[model samples]
Target: MTTADTPPRTLPSTSDNQLLADAGEGTRVEFRGLVKDYGTTRVLHGLDLDIAPGEFVSLLGPSGCGKTTALRVLAGLEAATEGSVRLGDVDVSRVPTNRRDIGMVFQSYSLFPHLRVLDNVSFGLRRRGMRKKDAARRATDALDLVGLDHLAERFPHQLSGGQQQRVALARALVTEPRVLLLDEPLSALDAKVRVQLRDEIRRIQLRLGITTVFVTHDQEEALAVSDRIAVMERGRIEQVGTPEDLYLRPASATVAAFVGVSSVVPGLAAGDRVEVWGRSLPLHTPGLNGDVEVFLRPENVLLVAPDGPSGIDATVQESTFMGNFRRTLVRTADGALVRVQHAASDHLEYAEGVRIELAVVPVAARARTATA
Candidate 1:
C-alpha cells in the first residue's frame, strides 16, 4: 500500500518517547513456506527464513528477484499467496500494515512535503492521539538520534536528499518498530551520501539493537551492512549466510557468479580433486565429475616469476591500478584470461606480453558441465 494510504496506526496511551527509549528486546522474524503469485506468475516459491532477535539481515538479489516482495510481505503491505509470517511468536501474515508494528524506509525517503522535519517525524505519534507538544518533543529526540535534530525546523524541500532521508529514518525509528524494513533505502542517494547514510543506519541499528531486514540489489552494499545475506534468484533464496560465507564459499554457481569478481576457468573434476591450468587443485563443491568450470576470485590467484615449480606459465595482457590494489590480466597458455589481484605497491611489472607465472590458491567452486 502507498504511504498516504496506510491505515491509522497510533498507540494513544503509550508515549512514543518511552516506547522508543525502552524499545523491548528486538523481536525475531520467521517466514515459513511463504509464497506469492501474480495470477499465473509466481514471484516467491515457498520461501523460508528465520531472523534472530536483533540480528541484521539483508535480502540481496538482482532486479525481478523476490527480495523486495519478501520485505513487503514482512511489512504487511502485500498479502502472501501462501505460508505464514511470524513476528516473535505472533503470526502477522494477515496483519494490516499499520498494525504489524514494523517501520519501513523506502528509496524515495517519503517525508511529507508540507510538514517540517519534526512534524513529519511525529505525524505517526500525533495520529495515535499523542499531545502535539509530546509528539514534537519525541520527534526531536528521534532526530537527534539520526544526527538531524538541527534540521528539525526545515521542510523537506528545504533539506538535502540525504537530510530528508535521515528525517524519514528518524520517523521510522521514533515509533520503535519491532522490526525495521529497509527497501532500497539508499538507492536514490549519491554514492557518497549512500555510503555515509548506510554507515549511519548500521551504527544506529547496532546501538538500538533492533532486528532489521535490508533489501538491496547492490552486492557491495549488502556485504558492508549485513550480518547475513539471503541471495535470491528467480523466486527462491539461492543461498543464505554471513557475507563471508556467501563470498568465500558460495553454495551454488549462481551465488558464486553474483557475489563478487569471480573468474571461471575450464577444468576437469574428479571427486575432491580438479585440474585447471595444467595444475591440480582441490575442489570444494561436491558431486562434480568430468569436464567442469572452476571459479575463483582474483585474490585467490597468486602471481610470481615463472621460474618456480609452483607457478603456471602466463603472459600479462593488461593491468589496471586500483587504489590500494592492482588488478592484472594474465592469459594462460590455454588462452584462459586469469586475473591476479595484489597490493598496488607490490610492483609486479605487468606490461603487455610480459611472461609471468600464476600459483592459484587450491580452494575453488566447481560447476558441472551441462550435457546438451
Candidate 2:
C-alpha cells in the first residue's frame, strides 16, 4: 500500500516537539537575572527569560535596548556581570563560544571567499577533527537541509545574496547546536527576498526543531516569524505574548504606539469617562481623571458623509495610494492630523480641500494618563 493510503504512523508535529505544557519544566534555555554593563552604563537590567525545548522566540526592540547584548551573552560571546546562564539544567556561564553548543547566523554573510560552498559548511566539522569523508557527508546533509546542495561546488562570490545567506544557515546548522542564535539575518536582503527567505528560514527551523532566539528591530518580521515575542524597552521587557495578543491588547501606551500606528487625541477625562472630538467613551479604569490622551487605531476609524451631523469635522489634508490600501491624512478643527487607512478599492473620492467626518468605534477608544 502507498504511504498515504496505508494507516498513517504517528509522527511528531513541530508544535508537539517545540511547545511545552510547563515551559519552565521543559525549558532548554534560561536567563536568570542577567545583567550587562558597559563601563558605568548598564545595558541589561536584571533580565530574566526562559525558552522551551524547541520554541522559536524573537527578541524584539529598538536599537540599543539590550536585545543584542542578551543574545550575545546566551551565545557566550559576552559575559554577564550578574545572574546566570543555563542550558538544559547545566550552567554554562563561563563556557567558551565554541564550546557552548550553540550556532549563530549574523546579518553579514561571513563565508570564506577562498572556500567552495561545501568546504565552507564543512569548516566547523573539520575543526572538530572529523575525517574528511565524514565531514563531507555531514556537509552535504546540511546543504540539502537548506536546499542548497546543488550549489555545493559554487564559490561564495558565484552565488546570489539569498543563496549566500542560505549557505551561512547551512554552515551554522552543520554543527548540530542545541540553541540557534539569529542576529538580523534577513536585514541585508531586499524586500522581496526578505519576505521569501523569512518563510524558508522558519520552515527549516521547524523541521529541525531547534530552539532559536532571533533578534530584530523590524516589527513586521518579528510578528510574522516568531512563535512568541518579547518586546524590550530601556533594558527591560515590556511584554511577551503571541502576535495576536500583543496587537489586540497592549498593556501600555508605549507598546501600542511601538507595535502599530495610533492616533493620540486630546480629551477631557472624569473617572472612567472621557470626551474626545465631541464623542463620549467609558474609560472603565480607576485613578484616571482630568486631561488624558485618547488612543485610536487607524483600522478602528471610519469615514462618513462630509456633512454628517454626528461625525467630527475634518479637512482632507493629503492622500496617497498604497496599492493594497489608501492612506488619507485628515486635519481636525484644532489642526491635528489623523491618518486613516482605507482599502485601495474604497471608491470614496477625496481631495485636499474637501471636508470629511471621522468616526470612532466604541471598542477602539482608550484613555491614558499623559507621560512627560
Cα shift from native, residue 73, model 2 (Å): 0.9
Candidate 2 C-alpha lDDT tens digits along 67-152:
99999999999999999899998999999888888889999999999999999999999999999999997788778766677889
Question: Candidate 2: misplaced stretches above 4 Å?
Answer: 1-27, 271-273, 282-286, 364-367
lDDT of 1 by residue, 3-35 (tens): 223332232232444544575558899999999
Best by TM-score: 1
Best by lDDT: 1
Clashing pairs in 1: none
Report the Cα lDDT for residue 300, model 2: 75
lDDT of each: 0.86, 0.82
- The runs of at least 3 residues in candidate 1 whose Cα sits more than 4 Å from the true structure, single-residue gaps closed, are 1-20, 306-310, 313-317, 352-355, 370-372
Q: Give per-model TM-scores.
A: 0.90, 0.88
